[model samples]
Target: MIRGRITGSVVSTRKLINLVGSKFMEVEYLRGGVSESLIAVDLVGAGIGEEVLVVTGSSSLRALEKDAPADAVIVGIID
Candidate 1:
């Protein structure tokens, strides 16, 4: 799992059928103290600037449907 902050949101008019109802968020994570960003499927409703826990790879897909085609997913929102 990776800890990151929700930097923004992604607007998609069309996406894969499995991802139709999923919300997407832009997350900013630190790597070697340098910031990097990635779009993650939001399983937990996280707002902009909120801290969140993210899962990647197969774990991310498991967090959603059987095969969500997602590389990242927001699993938790930090208080």
Candidate 2:
């Protein structure tokens, strides 16, 4: 898992069948106090500027496979 802050959102009209109804957000990856923005899938309802936890690899794949193609999935919203 990785810790990050939601930075923005992604909107796609033409996507794979699995990804039609999924929400995507851009997260600023964080380590300590530093961060770098990257894209992630939002299965959980996360808004921009919220802190969140992300899952990658097989865990991410499984979560994304539920509704869309996900390489990185938001697993939790952090307070």
Candidate 3:
């Protein structure tokens, strides 16, 4: 899991069938003190500027409870 924060949202007019209803967010994570960003599917309801926990790889598919073309997903919102 990666610790990150939701910076913004992504709007797609077209996407894979499996990801049609998913909400995407731009997440910023710290890597060696350098900031990096990735687009993540939101499983939990997380808003901008919120701290979140993101899972990648197969874990992202599991979080969606189905097969998706997603490589990253927001699993939890940090307090």
Candidate 4:
């Protein structure tokens, strides 16, 4: 899992059927001295500015609904 903060959100009205009901958020992760953000499907409810845990690849795919087509997923929010 990767640690990141919720930066924004994504709205897709024409996404795949499997992903239609899922909420997507932008999360920023630090790499070296720089930080980058990516869109992650929300597995847990996370608000902007909140620290969260992200899962990617096969683990993310398995954590979501069957055949969710998610490359990344926000699994948890940190206090």
Pairs of colliding residues, candidate 1 = none
C-alpha lDDT of all candidate models, in order: 0.89, 0.82, 0.90, 0.89
Would you estimate the TM-scores of all the predictions? 0.91, 0.82, 0.92, 0.93
Better of 3 and 4 by TM-score: 4
lDDT of 1 by residue, 11-61 (tens): 998788878888999999999999999999998778999999999887676
Q: Per-residue CA lDDT of candidate 4, range 2-53, in tens?
A: 8999989989898889988999999999988698888999878889999999
Stretches of candidate 3 off by over 4 Å are none
lDDT of 3 by residue, 41-66 (tens): 99888999999999988767766756
Worst 10 residues of 2 by lDDT: 62-71
As a whole number from 0 to 100, the lDDT of residue 7 in candidate 4 is: 87
Cα lDDT, model 2, residue 73: 87
Clashing pairs in 3: none
**Superposition TM-score, candidate 4 onto the true structure:** 0.93
Local accuracy of candidate 2 as per-residue lDDT tens digits, 1-79: 8888898998989988877778889988866767677788887898998989999766787765655566788989987
Error of 3 at 46 (Å): 0.4
